[model samples]
Target: MPRTPRSRSLRWADVAAWRLRRHHLRGPLTAPEPWQAVKDVSAALCGLHAQVMSSAEQAVAARTRLPDAGAAVREALWERRALVKTWAMRGTLHLLPAHELHLYVAALRDDRRQMGDRLLAQQGLTPGDVAVVLEALPTALGEDRLTREALAERLTAVTHDRTIGEKVRSGWGVLLKPAARRGLLCFGPNDGRNVTFCAPRYRLGADDERAERSTPTDPAQALGAVLRRYLHAYGPASPDDFARWWGTGTPEVRAALSALGDAVTATDIEGHRSWALRDDVADMAPAPTGDGPLVRLLPAFDPYIVGPSRQLVSLLPHPALRSKVSRTAGWISPVLILDGMIGGVWKAQRRVRHTEVEIEAFVPLSSGVRRRIAEEAEGLLAPGDGHGITVRFA
Candidate 1:
């Protein structure tokens, strides 16, 4: 396969519009059944950042029309087994569809190895120690869910290594993540306040068996699938962006992009080299012309804000506003996005009866925009009384 010819230069506006369109924010919202909606959006965005469970649910609710969408998301995880929370790209917890687990696990193989090495060194353990835990995990977990503490006890008994049990009980998830990446473990139902773990095979049950029978287990093919999905949802991006997003080396990302061949087209975004889907580049010429600003109240760690970028600081311009919205102690706060730029920071507090949403805008927002922000907050608190939602400008 030959590489697609480079398209004309793309501006910031083009990239922003492409993001909105690709994120399913431009057109009429299609409200599918709750589980289907979660699956659709999760797959579309590659995976949902689930470090904060409430935030992940809210992110899905913002895209779908389901009332009490958050509850539905939980149902999908605890009941339907449609979505599985596991350590994926960047070695962070994410909600990936159960059917696609194999692909993502395989795609993160290199990064997982690197992370495992660092973690093992930090724990003063060897690869042999990790293998012992891995070997014991499946039978220890069996068809039952075990809390981290309980699982650690089992590991201690099985491996007969007190240090392994101590590390597991420490809750760092260092040794456990390797097992997850290798498809030996995943999140199970919560045991009261504590989270539990079980084998992916046990969690998926018949679904896992079906997937194993049908899904290709080739790592190279899985890498290609992940790259294609990433580009589809967050393209017109550079290999550096992909590398950053995946937490993999740039050389590996470039190799995957190369294997994609003409499926990806090279272009210059804001004077920086980038790549996008061939069809997307063909349609993005002249960009999506519009002057009306689009306002979106995106939750913390939303995919739109988390996607790869070269000049995010320039998008906000103001130093203080940039700091507020961007990383601060590894936390990406909820943001108010106006026309593809980080316009302000927002925080929400759910009271007993109502949800209080406070917005801190970098620049004075127009009355209409403020109303739109209020409307968004109301929608976020929906299936509950709209009047119960309060939006305060700080």
Candidate 2:
């Protein structure tokens, strides 16, 4: 029998530094053009949560050496076409690198759209109606993209069912995520305030790219690939962490881990056991306990906070204060990290003249640390967002 890998004990500091490095938050990507910045950062972080476009851009900016967050992100999205924004990963909007669309869509098996038959029935939609819309999506979104309203009208025209209108009304776009997973629909460039939809170009010739004809053609393999990617970016995570992140169950995650075989290794952070990519095992070094606090202001829903199953207590050790970080109705507040632990929670409110970032620290902060936090916050500012940044403590 093969010997089990030794479980490495990790400190919260070590976990914090490693995660910050993996996320490109320790320091931005060396240097990249507007387009490459988005692609590189998105690929590195699995993908940026795009529910709030500004937040997604800030996340990229935090990871990249690029000057203007808006310029770099929009250039990659609209001009370079290097990134595709779509509903994915727990049926939420994400900014994913364009070249990896095939891998992501393949992992999201066609049968695994977000809405179930019961929910469809609740919307007065039948499976047949959903099928008709899924089939009609590609043709309607051909060549140019269409606004949600335009697509809804065309869907109604094609299906001859007015209920399709009810399904698309919510800004959340919960019902349409299924079609997006099928690779037939994605968010197109914005027409002023209106968001559009298009069929993403999933056939890229990147080194890792495969034709629809995959080598294995096994869904588990794709699932395993996704797990490997996630582990690299946010590893030393529990099986349940991946399950929750992917909206999967224990058995599915177990099988995916099994598919990795020796590619993954077990590890422990404190008393909690988790898994990490084999290659990453060698890099898990404990940050010197004597080192001064390190700080970074992460935007709301940054992959770092959402990726590792925050409930693990590794992110925020104080159980009573958990509500401050992860709030009601799934709101993850922008956070301040000190020496790899949740030292505080923060908010960046855009004022007409300036953006004020108010921090509520759970522990006292030193002047040097506060100054560093201000500098970090300035680097994350998007172009034309505000002329200046003010840091306030509460």
Worst 10 residues of 2 by lDDT: 202-211
Query: What is the clash count for each candidate, in the order shown?
Result: 0, 0
TM values, all candidates: 0.91, 0.91
Task: Give the residue spans of candidate 2 off by over 4 A.
Answer: 1-5, 110-113, 121-124, 169-172, 202-217, 288-291, 382-386
Write the residue-wise lDDT of candidate 1 on 126-179 in tens digits. 777777887998877887788998898888888877888987887478788878
Which lDDT value does model 1 have at 388?
87
Query: What's the lDDT of the predicted structure labeled candidate 1?
Result: 0.78
TM-score of 2: 0.91
lDDT of 2 by residue, 221-335 (tens): 7778888899999888878898888776667778888778888888888887888888997877755545566677878987888888544365665778888888898887888
